[model samples]
Target: MQIFGITSQELFGQLLLGLINGSFYAVLSLGLAVIFGLLNIINFSHGALYMLGAFLALLGLNHLGMNYWVALLVAPAVVGVLGVLVERLMLRHLYKLDHLYGLLLTFGLALVAEGSMRYFFGISGETYPVPEALQGGADLGFMFMPLYRGWVVVASLTVCFGTWYLIERTPLGATLRAATERPQLVQALGINVPVLVTATYAVGVALAGFAGVLAAPVVQVNPLMGSNLIIVVFAVVVIGGMGSILGSIVTGIALGIVEGLTKVIYPEASGVVIFVIMIVVLLVRPAGLFGKQA
Candidate 1:
């Protein structure tokens, strides 16, 4: 006797799992979109930066007795400041050149970051304890879902949409968008476009760092964690179209659900299904579902 006459626990479980994945995707893709749209760089270091955030949070918890809530806020600040330093010292210089150089530089940064972490940590992976407040489960009629997952879904949605509001409806956002499209003109209007650029990059990286804090309990906190998710995230970004925050958020969550459903119905194809859709979308809609058409 199913709730609506159609009941499959395995499928339901997969969806719950997918939604959790979606939360990560939403936050990560949002970060990617923020950097791409505002800073005009691929930010290949994004994944590594995320891992760094997770590691930082772990360090905070273990060494400094910092709570997850505190680490969530602080890690982003720390990572974001580093992002500012990178932009100020290196990324800012490549703005006038072809976008490829920025991409390559970020890729190099990713490699360096991953390598350094691997050297220090040896890739065994570390565990992050779940916050005590979220260590329970809710029993639905059909299945039991973890409370932590529900927390993740709610918190992630809030952050994603909150960011959307901040960037789309606010006066500060107008300056940011204007800065991205016409720095010279915006600068003429008395907004420090370069400062805004630096701030934007910092903010984007901070978002990634925040995501890492949220994800620490779910995934292994290893140096390789960032590289692992970055590929799928890039696919999400590609399908959603770069520089589109809403698109990324929607696509990431929707695709996660689709992937969840596929895993229940077609187990073997689950891994590559998103990529397959991506290829098909590329052929059918070169600019992607939300990208601007030529």
Candidate 2:
């Protein structure tokens, strides 16, 4: 039972791996989409914030005696609060400036965050043990599946769609959209537009934190973790279309699978496949797959 000169088990296994990777992609890109869509910030610091979340989880477990479940909640909340401070103190002042200014600021912030973490923790990675309940694997006929990997996919999808629903279907979402488009008009209606903006940024960064926590057990928790993945995430966001929530989610997952398949078919091409797709998409649809043409 082989297809494309590979055994069924091998193919299925790679697919599963791809799906797990896709899960991370979806969550990270969702955060990027949220920030760019709502606040128009490039958020180059997103990867750093993600690394912060993982470190918070690690530190909380080591110093505060917190568990994975607790860290899942607490890490994101702490990061979200930090995000609020960043927004109120820094990002708010740049709202009227060129997008490049915001990008540069966040990029510098990312470098600072990474540098501080590296200085304190060193570049070596640390392992985070999987939670007790999810520490095993299940036999899935074709392959053995790790419970944690399955959880990552399920959890990522839930968060991604839940976010989409929140921002697309609810009255709150409508208000948010209105505020972004016409802050003065929404303010006339007694909405605290600035607060909303700040909160939105917090939520965006919090999503990144949440993703980091989820990824901690699966990958080596290191200071350089975020920097390594952020470029790919940005590629996902662009391929999905800048500021398109659903686009980011779908494109991230799809590209992950594509990358995985490429690994099986041509190992050398796997790393650059997403970039190639991005190039093709850009040439064809400058607005992205889901973006509206301006």
Candidate 3:
């Protein structure tokens, strides 16, 4: 039962946890890649939107007497609408300006959201109870797998692949890509490029919201939650290449597993390992593992 100096059960457990983290990373990065690749905008507020999603879920449970199922359905729609408003009111004006303007605007938005939440909810996190349905563990020979965690992995991957297929393999995805690369031409062809852009941004942020709902039961639903993970997600985006959707998914999962292994072998390095990997990737292939050369 020993693998290296660790028990197989322990090793597998770490790997499973890593995979769960990777699932979140993959989904979040996928959303980032979609926004940046198509909209040419850096969504610094994505993490905040994610926080909002979890909070919204909490609000539903506390005030609305909604269950987890209802929160899962309502939270993303609410956040996605908020994203549309942000796009229409603010992001649209900045598209003609430098990308930095978009970054600054979203970064400021992130700050405002975090600050507001901190003021209202304080720095401490609100606990979200796992649904009765997913509240137990299953033995998997090597290790006992938490049902919620397994659900997270499966749900995340399903969403990731579904998004990828939508963007990479569908006609609507083709239209969106065309709009991104040749907006004037797409517009001339009678497609509403502006509307498409707004929709894309909404979809991107909605993804963050979806991830937040998935994560609410696992982690403390604090305002700083998204801020803390966004940096790592950005690193994942860089490592996977912003241009490649598949790259982001694969890289995120791989790094998560690597981080998990690091936790077992060298606990101190767990925190910094992803960043170090990012550094190495940049030095070797500046475009990223899946990014094309500029």
Q: Which number leads on lDDT?
A: 2
Candidate 3 yields a Cα-based lDDT of 0.93
Best by TM-score: 2
Indicate the TM-score of model 1: 0.96
Where does model 1 exceed 4 Å of error? 1-7
Tens digits of per-residue lDDT for model 3, 62-175: 998999988988999999899999999999998878989999999999999999999999999889999999999999998999999999999999999999999999999999
**Can you give the TM-score per candidate against the true fold?**
0.96, 0.99, 0.98
Candidate 2 per-residue C-alpha lDDT over 80-160 given as tens digits, one digit per residue, 9 for 90 to 100: 999999999999999999999899999999999999999999999999889999989999898889999999999999999
lDDT at position 184, candidate 2: 99
Q: Please list all clashing residue pairs in model 2, or write none if there are none.
A: none
The per-prediction CA RMSD against the true structure, in angstroms, equals 1.9, 0.7, 0.9
- Evaluate residue 65 in candidate 1 and report its C-alpha lDDT on the 0 to 100 scale: 99
Candidate 1 per-residue lDDT, tens place, 53-84, comes to: 99999999999999888898899999999999
The TM-score of candidate 2 is 0.99
Off by over 4 Å in 2: none
Question: For candidate 1, which ten residues in a row score worst on lDDT?
Answer: 1-10
Q: Against the unseen true structure, what C-alpha lDDT does each candidate score? A: 0.90, 0.94, 0.93
Q: Flag the better candidate by lDDT, 2 or 3.
A: 2
